[model samples]
Target: MKKVLILALLLISTVSFAQTISGKAYYQSKTTVDTDQFGGGEMSEEMKKQIMERMKSFLEKTYILTFSGSESIYKEQEKLEAGSGFGGMGAMMGSFSAGAQYKNLKTNQILEEREFFGKKFLINDTITNLEWEVGKESKQIGQYLAIKATAVKKIDPNDFEMARPRGRRGERGRNRDAEEDSEKVADTTQTESEDPFDQIEIPKQVIVTAWFTPQIPVANGPGEYAGLPGLILELNVERTTILCSKITLNTKETESIEAPNKGEEVTRAEYNKIIKEKMEEMREQFRGRGGRGGGRGRFGGF
Candidate 1:
């Protein structure tokens, strides 16, 4: 009996010391445009069809997420695009210069690193910031323990908009006039705010709720997300849910976990300038097209 008791205690200790977690992340999101912009008129059937087709193309692209503990990689196909084709066409008309492929537009990003309170955690680093939250509810995810947690995530619309190239530049005076006109239109469309959240457009704010399990004992999750008290076994954002599809623990570990060095090496200001220039170039191409009445938009063939 004593030997059996010692064996059980050893097993418990071993389980407590183990570290690692793995999972699959599923996500869903919709993209919509303001109908009041451009030519303010009722949308035609042809316009609606074009917008839907564009949205579908945008969502199908994939994104990559990496972190210190684990990485989540997947793709989101285009879902819906409402409003008029004029605005959509104006937005993308500038891609002619960069050889921009519509397929290259990524609506999502792969899980990268999560920084919390100045501490950095990395995959393959072995030492991670993940810790299990005690006394939390758990749900069975396959053979793993899934704990629940919520986080209110705020994203800047400009960040998302900049992901895709903007089309051509208008004449100096014309551009300023257009800008002023757009602001006026935006002011008129503002809805009365009942709640602080309602003041912002629905696409602008997103709340991310996640489920994790101490089974991995590392407070890590996919993308640049972390700081929960456990390894995130599942995450739900918008209407999509990412669950732990698979896990490998106490196996032969290979390779070291490190931070990823991707994306353009530019400051925020510089990046903005580049985007503006590209948009201007696109605008020039649009004007050269001899108006929108011609055969499809710039991307019609592709």
Candidate 2:
């Protein structure tokens, strides 16, 4: 009888511990400028329209993510450009150039795609870094216990450089100068002097923060993020924030979680190689124009 009682108690404990809770997540993120300049340089109306159009194009891209032990599904919307330029005509121009209706307005989109156990969901980029901490526990979010957490992450300043692509002209000129100096030194048998700007590296950084709930017991959060005790239902990274506006628990149905088949996953070094190759391809495409500023008119009077 004692053994039977012990076995029953163990079973009860297991069942109690296996209980799953569901809830929404909320987070606050603060953005910091790491570059010397806070915003991009002045651009003409046409140039701005063109840039906005490209941004809208990027908004069309999408991905999927999934989680374990939960029936509630989450989806992330793509980022779209917002705001008007000069007047209604400028706004109309922006809308027509981007091929999108004003109804679809998204500022930023998530970049990471995740899959688990045959199901896929999009990662929310709104959450930068997800961390957990002990605090005054609350039972506001369903049967789940909740605690507040915070995390900070830096944004890549090179994103602006890539978007502008103007500094490359200066870099190409320096390369030409170095080549000329090499030729001169070889012809005259004189040592060549180092270029003053050759060793300088540009500084860039942006910081973001987030809050998380650890009751769900999974270390997965959102985007290229993990390491939390529960699934991240909300995120606030950069100027964007995603809140778990709704959630549903187990019903009469079951859903499988699966890993997403992201094509051509590569290491950091491999990605860099791809970027370098693409940049070279672009340079070659516009070679005769003068390399970076080869065709000034193409940049649209920036």
Candidate 3:
């Protein structure tokens, strides 16, 4: 009994000490898209450039993740406004936003702040444990030795997030939204054949190549990426590549890291249900407009 008690206390002390080692990692993410798919095959160079330019809002972004031990706070950095001179059509582009993601590996939970239709939501859910295969390959990322690791993830089509569909003008993605309401709601519904997301086509598997350093000793990275032996300095998911631009370790100030509690608390399954319902609601509102039973509504709404 005495030996067991001493061992337990040592383990507890080790955990507490690990939590004190904190750092800030700045990551820049970039994604590429085929223009022909969105532009209907043949298009002039100018048209392709314009489309790609608009897509920069979704394809390219930057984020800062403050982390220590099993906790992390990942948030997108402020972006500068840029777009074509066109009146208001620039707002129709899709957005790629994961919002402020707060993760606690100790509890296997993630609290992500999301916005839709001008409302903010706090999605509280369990962390997804992605199976990663560590490789013998090694590389240097910003003076830190990083080992290569890969994960094959099966993505869900229904999990796709479209940019905010604004009318004629304004910012895309999470650019248009509200702060947070204390009211919390959880969705209680099972996946059915009538699920709207069933219509979306999802790929079977996606390859994720990441480079992490055991030196950092934190299984954290940008977006929903983790499960490595160390901090991920670079990650390639599908067509998007996130690279760590800068890393500042053990700052003079210890930042506070906690779960976001402002919006509704719902599980990942529940959040997916909410998104599907909201999309169906939008579709129903436009049902009468030249589409099957009615008009085309606003042709490219989402």
lDDT of each: 0.40, 0.35, 0.63
Question: Candidate 1, 51: how far from true, in Å?
Answer: 7.3
Candidate 1 regions exceeding 4 Å error are 1-138, 161-204, 239-244, 250-254, 257-263, 267-302
Error of 3 at 81 (Å): 6.4
TM-score of each: 0.43, 0.42, 0.72
Better of 1 and 3 by lDDT: 3
Off by over 4 Å in 3: 1-17, 80-97, 162-200, 251-253, 284-287, 291-302
State which candidate, 1 or 3, has the greater TM-score: 3
Q: 1-302, model 3: which lDDT tens digit per residue?
A: 66446434543554455476788999998876644333223468888887777657667888999987778899889664433332222321222225689988778888998765445678888777776767679998889999998878765545645322112121232322231111011011101112222223345467789999877767677877776667889998756789999998883556778767776777777776776666666456444432232112232333
Estimate, for each residue in 75-125, the C-alpha lDDT of model 1 and write its tens digit: 332322222243433334322121111110012222223221122322222
What lDDT does candidate 2 reach at residue 181?
52
Worst 10 residues of 3 by lDDT: 179-188
By lDDT, who's the top model here?
A: 3
Candidate 3, residue 64: lDDT: 95
When sorted by lDDT, best at the front, the candidate numbers are 3, 1, 2
TM-score between candidate 2 and the true structure: 0.42
Lowest summed lDDT over 10 consecutive residues: which window, candidate 2? 97-106
